[model samples]
Target: MIITSAKLFEEILAILKDEDNIFVIGCNVCAAKLRTGGEPEVLEMCRRLEESGKHVVGWTLPTAACSIRSFESLVEKNEKINEAFCILVMGCGSGVSSVANVAEVPVYGSNDTLSLGGSSGGKLLSEQCVMCGNCTIGEFGGLCPKAQCPKGLLNGPCGGAVDGKCEVARVNDCVWTLIYERLKKIKRLDLLYVIHAPQEHGFK
Candidate 1:
């Protein structure tokens, strides 16, 4: 799912101002987990818009924003939303598109579409994997050295590997150390002794 921010709020407000009846729709699945949109955010925005004299017809949160199956529940619950001049989407791009597809109404996004990721903590979106379509774990012993290492080191610990921690960031565990441990666990530590010669400058 895509991420969203407050910058997209302006675009949403601009499109929704003239609309008399508005339905603020939130998604409980990806959008909720990512802290971008959910019931709380939807209700808050609904109240604010209603206070500003806009006729906020109603609000609803579908369990799965991308699933049209659960969207049936929205019809039974939020019948007033049909009166809405426009539907406000408090979810990612996919969720917004899905809602628009099912509702058959004008959908306005309340958030910007960012890359796919997960939240490690409260509102902290950490990019764990890049999905580069390339694998290099054979040389690195199964650990993602490119992502976990301080400097994305692949060959070995650079000028930094102090006491099994990264020299660049003391709090970070050295990727080489993880690789070494993994190799030892699999009885492949002997592979570490194999020297890797520097490559020539030729394009080949």
Candidate 2:
């Protein structure tokens, strides 16, 4: 899932300093799961804005704010959205961009978009992928070195790998070591002999 966190209230206030009539939009999916955006978040933001003496023209919680079609449908249903002087998006970067693409008024983000992550534990999200386009997890026994290794190394337990731990991030296990162990357990140790080419860089 795409992780997100609310932007500081001070930062949001600064961005909306010149605007009065604000429309808030939230995502019902990823952002909601992260507690950064959703119906409750949208209502809370509206309350905050109103308490600050700013007008909240309307608010919406789109099923998937990042989806163009979903955003379009929201816009169609929320006529008050057009009455606002500006829009505050309480979702990820993608959701903000989606709203900006079709919004008549200027769009501003109220959340900081973070990496692709999954729940590591209760209310804790840990990044799992960097979306490098070229996936090589199969060779590494499904472990992503790009995400697990601090250096984003493709072929390594770098020279700094020690005692199955990463030298850069001393607390975490070396991803390469995990990969090696997993491969050994699966009897696919020969795959380690195969050298992977450098990842091709550029837009996917």
Q: Largest lDDT belongs to which candidate?
A: 2
Clashes of each: 0, 0
Pairs in steric clash, model 1 = none
Model 2: per-residue Cα lDDT over 1-204, one tens digit each: 788989988899999999989999989998898889988888988999999999999988888778867445766868788688999999889999998888778999999887888875575545678887877778888788878888877777688977888899898888889889999999999988888776656413
Q: What is the lDDT of residue 173 in candidate 2?
A: 84
| Model 1, runs deviating above 4 Å | 120-125, 130-204
Give the per-residue lDDT digits (tens) of candidate 1, residues 54-96: 8889888878666656446677778887787788888877777
Pairs in steric clash, model 2: none
TM-score of each: 0.62, 0.86
Assess each prediction's global lDDT (C-alpha) against the native.
0.71, 0.84
Error of 2 at 22 (Å): 0.6
